[model samples]
Target: MEKKVFLLPFASVILLLHYWVTCLTLAVSLTNLSDEYALLALKAHITYDSQGILATNWSSTTSYCNWFGVSCNAHHGRLTALNLSNMGLEGTIPPQVSNLSFLASLDLSDNYFHASLPNEIGNCRQLRQLYFFNNELTGSIPQSLGNLSKLEESYLDSNHLTGDIPEEMSNLLSLKILSLFVNNLTGSIPSGIFNISSLQSISLSANDLYGNLPMDMCDRIPNLNGLYLSYNQLSGQIPTSLHNCAKLQLISLSYNEFIGSIPKGIGNLSELEVLYLGQKHLTGEIPEALFNISSLRIFDLPSNNLSGTLPSSMCCNLPSLEVISLSWNQLKGKIPSSLSHCQELRTLSLSFNQFTGSIPLGIGNLSKLEELYLGINNLTEYGSEGIVSTSDVYSNGIMLLEVFARKKPTDEMFVGDPTLKSWVESLASTVMEFVDTNLLDKEDEHFAIKENCVLCIMALALECTAESPEDRINMRDVVARLKKIRIKLLM
Candidate 1:
């Protein structure tokens, strides 16, 4: 019995020693991944305890799974993801992140992270989604990213990243969404980057990328739905091959150096809702096929050399259009009355053109219209007898009259002759009668004009008629009197 007791004690000692050795090994391995230099930089932005550790009560040695912004597999006790978005973290990405060999996702967006991406990131071979957008990150994209063969989505936009996009990224054959827009990237886009059959969305806008776009861009990426290449230096015509991209939903190639007539086959993109090709060198008449795209919601082609009359049946078929801008083009003809059928219209700008005829009365029926710009055009009003003249019922309202009078002298029909002093006396009597009867009633006793009201009114009348017969005060004298009275009471 004594021998058995000794063996039991000996076995307990051996087990305790084994446990200690295993714990020591784990601590040493974790120390290599701690990245002390980066940890110090992070500590500079945080308050630390007396032990020179971050001022947090969590135990880091027990299990990093319970650490902030970390998730792990319960069975394997391995870290799988780290989401530290919008955490206000300021510093360079630490190389120690390479220790998380099984990490599948990492999100550090909307923070102040700076400097080049750590080369050690290539160690996360299992990573699928990497988000580092909206940061102060600099330096060229690390070519080692090709190690992530399984990456599906990568967003590094809105950063200061410069130099050519690494050609090595073409290795990520499984990539679906890649957004590197709003960066300082230069050089021609890597050919065949879109050759990946799985690509669904790609946004490289607001960059300095030059050279013709890939001819097979749309054909190779069959699943691509959104492609934004605006604000670049890309030249050459839009590839006609893009018509094959049946699933394309949004395409913006605005503010580029592209030249050629817009492809008529654009109508083939039945799923397209937003198409912005404005501020490019594209010429020729807008394709009638474009008007037939029933799914179009935003069609912006402003500041182009497009000419010819707009198709009257344009908006007649597009009931989903909300914003349409064809301004600063050479388009002629009258505004389409059928545009009123677009009940969802919010903004319509067709300014700086040679369009003639009356403004469509149907335009007033567009209840959702908020902004309408028809300036610098030859739009004349039609009379009731179908004669082309400026005589519509709502033609000359107070606002329009003021704007016109400010620009040029008013006509005698609008403002009476001022050459004859007798004409002035007759105008003053008529104006006084209108004011006394309609304005100065007993109900207005509480709202009396100031003591200088009469002098101000007479001065205004004299100054208004001193120019010429066509510059005299007509019925505007009454409006002036009413306005002066309101101003005096407010003062």
Candidate 2:
């Protein structure tokens, strides 16, 4: 008919080019035998790899592309990566490792892998990183790993996981370090995973997560840097846009039950460094822009309900303060002789507070003060040393020797005695000659008292009856000169 109608359109264009090259050679031989039967179904469920190192080279006479945590791709040999980190590799994980469909990275971290997590690992689809941290895995998580879509770093931390947390991992969107912490996971953190903008670490600490905290924390993950919500049950407040993230650096929300305050612009971040909000129920007054965050280094807040008075210009912007636990709070004033300029302070807890005064003689210049807790406050000594004696129980040394021998401090049953430590060292050379008439008592009786506070209470009873205990005087330097003479008699 016209040469069979031009050879029937050239044999239907060579039969549609041999039917797409026989369907692309049967899809690259079923993707190289589906990566050797998905690494022989993860080495037949590896009952225990106890360093027989993948059971003596995962055999079949080798060449399953040279096995052992296989890593191929030498000019498209496929199976991209499988680290086997900390290789104490135990079992489980095998949903045939989703046939390692061109896996991009799968470091079985700190191995000991147990149950749940292999929802066929979303068939890998070129996964980018799924390190199962610490291991001993349990249920939840694995909503088909949000269909991967090239996932990027999802370390299932500590493991022993429980329910919730998988709001389909907010469809990945190329996630970045979403380490589900300690795990026993419960509800309420799925505010679409903090509106992931390629999250930069969102630990979700020791979970049991409760509500509140998604007021666009940090304008939607502006490259957030570590926000490990500590032992949870998280409550309201605290989300003052978390200081707009500004590349935050660790804000570990400790043992939560959170309540108001603490958000006084959290020092505007400035590349913060560890600001743990301990056992929360937070209240106000600690905001001196948090000591101007000079790249603070560990500023933990203890049992909260914080109060006022600590702002000595934030202790000279602490040159990298190191651990200042605001101990069991209800915190009151004066524990700040500008924290001795935070010379790398190391743990200073202000225990059970109501803090009255003195305890800061430039805290003997800190010298790396190691864990000091001013127990049940209303403090007295610490800074210039001498914590207590004269039978302490706030002994106030027999009421500072009856308020400096104005009478009856000369005990030992004084009848006509010059005893009480020789009548206070015979007035240590006339104790500044009674403050050389430094008067100023504009008061209408009721025991007026104010000749430089009776010459600093007779030079603090001759520096506590001197005669050497290093010449005494350290009831916090006489309560810091009676708090500068009671702030000049309350102005």
Candidate 3:
């Protein structure tokens, strides 16, 4: 009787152990199957796999972790990252992607992916880095994305996305870089975006966004490094508190409808490098304090109503100065000879202003000068020989006439006068005569404006005036060729 009792208890113990082992094995197999199914769904949705990347590599017979562009955690065997950038793959993101509950990073940049991002993406609680730039994806950003509390970087630029940036984006408290440029988005920028304290870069340029910037933009964003709000319709006075961003390296707020004087406080940012405030309605003198920033490289404040002569000691404190474009302003007085001190200067544009006197002869000392535009001013010939090169004269004249001339060919002013085409053609030959005296180098004057160079400039101008807009050269190509001509002149 004692032996029977001991054997019965031993048998029961073995049975319990077997049951627990079977349950653990089944649970692990189910977890593996779930991740595998999610990946298979993604492959099924891909319409065009040009290189057969998913077709050949992602198979049910293979382990999901071994698939191309995929990584799995060693301990838990869960998907952690998937990077398929520039893969030549085309597809819509499947909702089943949300099944990757352990996914942390997903990169689909530089591809041909189209269609709206799946709202189910918000369910991936572990997602941190998301890259969807340079795709053909359309539709507004999903508001459900705000649920990604741990998201760090989000790139959605160079797409056809329209509609307002979802106000719910404020919920991404851990966000750092937010790039949404080159889209068709409209409406005022959400004020809540400025309240995200952890943000480091905000790029919302090349859109139709309008409205005033928040009054206290820099108060909440202490770590901000770049602010690119250019090429938008934003209006109103620039906030006076912009200089509070101590770490700012780039501030591009050009091509807007902003009115009033530029906030002088911006000069206080010691780390500022590039400042572009061109093509706006800003008035008043260029702040003298801006010339004192030693780190400033490009100071572009063109096409505004700014007046007053440039400070004579402009280049004294600006050690890193490279390009100075202050064209189409009402600035007066003699061109400052002090500009010759900018050793790093590559481009110096001071055209279409009311400045008088000969071009400063000292400019010839800038051996690094590539582009020098000093046309359309009440200036005389160089008083000294071999002062500066006038190789870019013809092209500069073409741009000035095409961009600013108001007298049309059909206008009454041309009733008995030369037709616009004949006028341009006649002037093309004698264009060099009106070239600013400051730009001519008497020693190598023959090389300054070559005959072929003149013909090229005239051809470009005539093509630009084509009756059909499509017949004209692409503006991008025109600008690029002009830059090339300037470079060849120096060579």
The per-model lDDT (C-alpha) reads: 0.71, 0.73, 0.80
Model 1, C-alpha of 473: deviation from truth (Å):
17
Against the true structure, what is each candidate's TM-score?
Answer: 0.70, 0.32, 0.79
- Per residue, candidate 3 scores C-alpha lDDT tens digits across 1-491 of 45553345878889999999999888977887878898888888899998998999998788999999999999878899999999998988899999898999999999899998888999988899999999999998989899999999999999999999999899999999999999999999888899999999999999999999986899889789899898899999888878888898888888899999988888898999999888749999988899999999988887889999988899989878988888778999988888888989877877778988877767878888755667677877543435532323332543544353422232222335565555766666665543333433346556445444545656676665454445656656777877776676556
On residues 1-491, what C-alpha lDDT tens digit does candidate 2 reach at each position? 45543345878999999999999988987788888888878878868887787778878776677887778888768778878788787888778878777888989889888888878788788988888889898988878888886788888889889999878878888898888888798989777777778888888888798999976678887888888888889888778887777888888887788888888877888888888887748888888877887898778887778888778667697689776767667878777677878888765656667887767666556778643556567876443354334212122433454344433321113324554445555664554332232243235362254444555555565565454455566566767876887777666
Instruction: Report the C-alpha displacement of residue 489, candidate 1, in angstroms.
Output: 39
For every model shown, the clashing-pair count is 0, 0, 2
Clashing pairs for model 3 are 382-437, 386-442
- Candidate 3, residue 329: how far the Cα is off, in Å: 1.1
Which candidate has the top score in lDDT? Answer: 3
Best-to-worst ranking by TM-score: 3, 1, 2
lDDT of 1 by residue, 224-268 (tens): 898889888999989887788889999989888999888887888
Against the true structure, candidate 1 has what lDDT? 0.71
Give the least accurate 10-residue stretch of model 2, judged by summed lDDT.
406-415
